[model samples]
Target: MTTEPCVAAPVRRGVAWHTPLSVAVLCAAVWLAHSHWPLLRGGAGRLAAADQGWLLLGATATLATWASAALAQQGAVPRRLPGARLVAAQFAASAANHVLPAGVGASAVNLRFLMRCGLPAARSASALAVKAAAAALVRVALIAVLAPACPGVVRLPGVSPTGAAVVAATAAGLVLLLCGPLRPRCRRALAAVGGDLRAVHARPGRAAALWGGSLAFAALHALVLVAVARSVELPLPPARVALLYVAASTAAALLPTPGGLGSLDAALVLALAAAGAPGATAASTVLGYRLLTVWLPLVPGLLVLGVLVRRRAL
Candidate 1:
């Protein structure tokens, strides 16, 4: 009797030099665009230098957002990554995300790190799914809550016809995809992509907690955006500041810019102006915010990348 030869299991892919290099080029392009955004908008010259309170508050809030996001990541996956370890992973992920193409390299870093932490590939994929869902839920809840509080948010030009429609459609589509026949198809698609998902459906309480955490995290980040605005002497309200921050941040994150680099700067300037802030102040505020959030992270990310590469951990 002739026996069929055993099939080979799929091997994990190696990191390629070209991949990182292309991502780096994208990052550089985005960073350059961000650096020049204020100048392009003719607002660079009018910016008031960031004051101490603004810087301090903004920095603190940004840290809080980062920490909370790290915790959310842990909660979603529960690969038993220690807080410190997870924090380091987050930093590495953020660094890679900023320096990678499509911002997807961060997911690779995360997958590798979790695997090293002893999670099965399937479980890790599930964790990523949960984290993504939780983040989306939180963002949606924010828009629902804030849209009412900030009346002008619903009134922006093209808000109702286009933005709102797209938002509603996207949210509905996600809901549909997560239910019934659509869900089965979605799961199959994910499975095709090497996602051996052991389904861990989100419980209501857990979902609430996750969304709550994300909301608080986003709010803190919004406060930082406000601080940056104030630092540039923008005459904008805190509510408007928060609303626009959420909207623009959502847009930038969805965009394919490296870590939303250039898009983020432009988004802030536009959102601030739409929310009634002066153009010059909005432009400068965006520049200052990018400096703290994006530019400040680059050096550490590079350091982490070097270390990770040397250790063969990436």
Candidate 2:
């Protein structure tokens, strides 16, 4: 008989037992933390399923923004990068990011994936930085354009107008500062991102395409937020939703909780409540929106996490 490898089979059993058990424990923790919700009554029960159009819109907007971001990167990447490949990588990365603790885990995985695609580690870092900066800039631009439209976003519960202004300023300042002061290579990296209009000087059309993609992303994403808000008949107008979506999103990202989890849910619920929704109704409405927005994406993301780990891609 051929000699067998000495790995213990019990190790596999141990792992299997631990993984699910840990997941169950974490899930139980989440449930307990969010258990403060009052039991939904009649109107609240209806709110849970009412006017789901905004959820759909939000989903579509989210999908569109991610696709556009990937496509834009492909257009400006150094090598003749394949758009489909990057998009797939992005999807895998997103899934990983959503389920994994802390957001950087996904970025690390994405950076590793890119490195495997033949980029040097240092260069990959630069590319990630550039991509992040561009996205932030675009987000800030959108808020400025849209924020004026929804000046009353200040009215949302727990929302301080001054806090909103500071957030917007910080986003703009940080991104612009990074883009301007990087080394020559970093500057080239941004150009390779198509943010360098000079390289495409002979073809301004590419630059136009980049701006167009960004604009489309902003519009569609704002529409989705407005729709999600409407699903519950929150007192906030669609214009307010459109304009303040970026700011609210930035604040959501700042939360320490993984995936912003219960914190985001609470923020949305409170915002709706401030918009004149009953507290219980707001809770159910927010919960329903999460079922559509968070859970829908999260399930596939967990599966993708397996692929990332198995491939050692992170």
Once fitted onto the true fold, the runs of candidate 1 whose alpha carbons sit more than 4 angstroms away are 1-48, 155-185, 189-209, 312-314
Determine which window of 10 residues in candidate 2 has minimal summed lDDT.
1-10
Instruction: Give a tens-digit lDDT track for model 2, residues 166-269.
Output: 98999999778777775565666655544333443335554454555556655765666566667767666677655555665556777766656666667766
The numbered model that scores best in lDDT is: 1
lDDT for residue 283 in candidate 1, whole number 0-100? 72
Q: What is the lDDT of residue 226 in candidate 1?
A: 83
Listed per candidate, the RMSD to the true structure in angstroms reads 8.0, 9.8
- What tens digits encode model 1's per-residue C-alpha lDDT throughout 74-107? 6565233556656666676776787665568667
The TM-scores of all predictions, comma-separated, are 0.71, 0.63
